[model samples]
Target: MPKEREWLTFYDWARTYGNYFYLSILGQPILVLNTHDVVSDLLEKRSGIYSSRPRLVMAGDLVGFDQAIALMPYSERFRQLRRLIQRELNAKALEKYWPLHEQESRELAKNLISHPTEMQSYIRHYAGSVILKVTYGYQTQPKDDPFLLLAEKVMQAFSMASQPGAWLVDLVPWLRYLPSWSPGAGFQSTAKKWSDLHMQVINGPYDWAMRNQGLPALAKPNFVSTVINQTDADLTEEEQSLLLWSSASLFGGGADTTVAALSSFFLAMALYPGVQQRGYTEIQKVVGKDRLPSVSDRKHLPYVECIMYEVLRWNPVTPLGVPHMLVEADVYEGYHIPAKTIIMPNIWAMLHEPSIFPEPHSFLPERFVGNEAAVKEVSVAFGFGRRACPGVAFAESSMFVAIATALSTVIIANARDMQGKDITREVPYKTGTISHPPAFTCSLTPRDGAELLSIRT
Candidate 1:
């Protein structure tokens, strides 16, 4: 297996081995689901057995991310956490946060205008700020906020720790018991440091929310506040722990993924000037320059919606999504999948499948325009069945408003070299658990009537 960009390897193998294939690494069974059909059949059709998560010793057990919803096993505890999270993040419940999304979208535009060169950092800040506000009602400082910094640290730790086959302890669970003085025990020290940071991120924001209970009556209730209000003043220990870690899990589940999608959005605009112009024209026609685009305007602006869909399909947030564990052996097509097998849905391959999406490598939003049937396939980027991201409604709203607002206020173009030539000629994206475009030069200049950037809620 290739160390990095394993999705590409999986995509290649899918063509050779048909839809699905199995591999045994040190006696651990692994299943790689490559096609949309195979993924839908197993992950969606038979979700009960395919929804559990395999344990990652480094990320889950050592760094203590097992408490997070993404890493939790399929059990009563997992169900409870999912229910609590979904209660606040579901589509109907998300309507009240439209102003929050629009407010942050305006903030993102302002940040880009002030510091255009730091697009990636500002985008990360935008994502972090929204999730922080929604989860904890903790507003982020303009630059280098402590909470944002803490979230970034946890993401870095998660990306490294949760990587499949990265840590020997995952393959050999017994190695976790090795003494620190022993050889190859270096991971123990690293896990210790990450574990400390993980605890800080988990506790800091929730504690802040608990202490700041004297907000004005008019203040919009956030996830933490809303959940607290749902119950009596006195809470059980399990409820408190669930609220804290579930809120922390919001950052892990939502922020980084949004950053990746938006970063890809900028890259897509810079590379494909024609697509950018088309999107801009659609926004201008549907949503005039009088004000910024609202989430409600999304339905009317179909092309802009297409552009958002294309960004997700162009390079998914997670090439190979969080692996699911198979509970109890199952048989499909005479093939036996053993219990406890790690099932990896090759999301990249499904998005790029030629039969489903012709000219898959190209960034074309028209593929989704007027094709309701095809648009459903793009949801594969999120995940399948019970394990699908709970924040889909929130994520989609954030992306639409950001895309429409950016198109309206600023011009996203390739930065010019000394010779006045476009600096970024290739469409290159960085490889990781979450795929993102490597930092590249881009010029974001204000458009006509740029005063619209000052959007008041």
Candidate 2:
């Protein structure tokens, strides 16, 4: 079994061995790619064979049934789903939703100022609301909004099922034949419940919008409503359910990752004040204290952009990335990789490779400044190959805007310890399928009166 200490385990293995290493976990062949060259070579160059997903027998059989695009093989259906997502979430489409992102971000700033102690929850709410609005054309107002609650529960179930040791049925497919009354059967039941509830929430709003399609366009556009009401097709009920679930998948896949990345940004800022100061100074000089930053300003704000890159590299949210499967047998460096073999790009190792990143443990954004090649290397944190996150444009814009606004307006400080010293280091993290820093306290004080007003406005 893989050890519970995720980064430490991967780091020790990568430092002892070189870039690519293999391990047998629960009778499954697992390959870990630790270097940039190998990751690029396999996931990018050989994408034709490396873009498939490893089979999750339990999750696939009981829950997705090849419906979830993220877990589906590179087939026609996958292509169609990817195309739909691209049309809805690509750069151009994302621009259409900038107003929503901007509005919610402003709300985020206001919430943070009023209740700084609830920063994590507010950040989560903001991200969820943005994604929900884009996907379902609705906003989550209260903290306990039903849609948000369902989305969170579904995500929790997914996270649990995705973990390495979560299910023995994954290792031994024969165990799946056992009766529901048997031990470990709860996972099966929970999987069905999650799947059913997910379909309900995803399809309910879509159906309602379709019935109301003749009305004027909604003040807030929703992807699901647009697709359902606009597209001229005789889609089967199953197909419609699948489409809705796919859109919901975006909410599940995207919200937590974006929120965690932002959280890591704050942690990096608190731990590395010098880098934070440099970013603040750059944003202050370039953007001034007058208005909020926008996507167009990214080019002029390279230093702040580098800080974003460094945060991604410092602690990637999807450390193992969505695992890719090989469709055809292949060989590399005298190693025989068979068809249907599961491959994992050990992104943690790649980003932390000592030779690639000097003082790999430290947070250093300067290395990315004025270095085009370094910036490209950092982009690998999002994964590689054909299945790379299609939401990259949206994610990058959101992070860039949030980071810029925070740096330009607020002072992110570490909470003091009982001994009157900085207690940022005292904060720890919980290990899981998606790596997240444990909740920590930080003070977001306004830099000055003008900045405070700017944030509020």
Candidate 3:
């Protein structure tokens, strides 16, 4: 458990210690599973006893996020709550929401063409608007949306609180229960500030839906409204509260992670021109210039699909999954394991394993395209077993359509400086549980006469 931003240093330790290792941090035991096979065997095969989450005192309870589906303790109620999210986000259900995705994705291409310099803002807006509309039926403002800012602020606080040893109170559970005035409890103040904003995200949309329930013609159907309409009499207060939190996790889980990966997609396009050109050619031949790409085009454009996989493989957003807590003790390879130990999957190490992926360091989609059989496994980056992200189908659809449309309509190039030389320097990604490509100058130009339609459409 490193306190500093050098958490990836554990990757070096993985090289020396082999895939699996156990250690004790401040008297708390931790099991680090690094290889894909071991993670599948332990976390996937033995999910019954490994699906619980380690109690995050500061980030969860104190910040009013304990109710969040991702942070909730392993319980039947939480499982049911997550199932609700899965029902709405599964591939079949997501098709009904394609109008939302198609409209925003088209806006994404137009936004890139209109504001080439602010790729970060438009990328975030594209992802956020999709989730915002689907989950809350709320339309997003073009820039400086209040809801987007609050969500980012709340999400930022959670990210800060999740560092290995940033908050001592999280390590010492008793410290979290102390009064607000207690010394060394500044985290409580910080948590309150974020939770206040969190309340708006949690209740604002739900309450709006409740007030507009009867007027079907005036109402904009969304996830919150759908859940409310189907279960008003059957749902207990606790169940309703669970639904609210699970739905709000869309912004935290869906928007941030999706936006981060899409940003990496842009970086990859800039760095690997040949791969980008091939992907562009594939999109051109399949979809042509009459219209922008759509979700239906994904199956025909396998190379573009490979680019999405390679982007995720190259830079996983959550390298170390939300830690899993053990519910029972078991021995693996004759080693003694104890119950209640925290299980941490080193996803970065597994995805970068050279034996599984030749030239793993390179950004090559051909590795996945050439051998489809080897890649036929569940995604570990989103998570594994029962605790896997419920939004995988929805997320992949969002990335696929956006990438396809962008490739068909734009050319991602290196920015040029005053001397006419490309400013091709790259910055290191910020260190965190959720990582993103650092801000860099990149030139985005429309492709041919077809892009003129993109601008007007």
* 1-457: candidate 2 lDDT, tens digit per residue: 5646455676677768767777776678877787779888888999989998877866676666346666777887787777778777878777877767766776777677778788888888877888877777765765777776666666666665665545778777787787888987766787788778667666655565556555654435778766765568866876676566668566666788888888888878878888889988887788776777766788899999988888898888877776788899899988898787778777777777766778877889887878777778777777787888778888888888778777766778885433545655435545655777766767887665334544454
Q: Count the clashes in each prediction.
A: 0, 0, 0
lDDT of 3 by residue, 353-411 (tens): 78777787678888887676436532777898888988998898999988887887789
The order of the candidates by TM-score, greatest first, is 1, 3, 2
- Candidate number with greatest TM-score: 1
Q: Per-residue lDDT for 30-139 in model 1, tens only?
A: 99999889998999999999999998998888999888888888889888888999989889999999999999999999889889988889999999989888888888
Local distance difference test, each candidate: 0.87, 0.74, 0.78
Better model by lDDT, 1 or 2? Answer: 1
Quality of model 2 by C-alpha lDDT: 0.74
Judge candidate 3 against the unseen true structure and give its global Cα lDDT, from 0 to 1.
Answer: 0.78
Clashing residue pairs in candidate 1, if any?
none
- Residue ranges of candidate 1 with Cα displaced over 4 Å: 216-219, 415-426, 455-457
The window of 10 residues in a row where model 3 has the poorest summed lDDT is 418-427
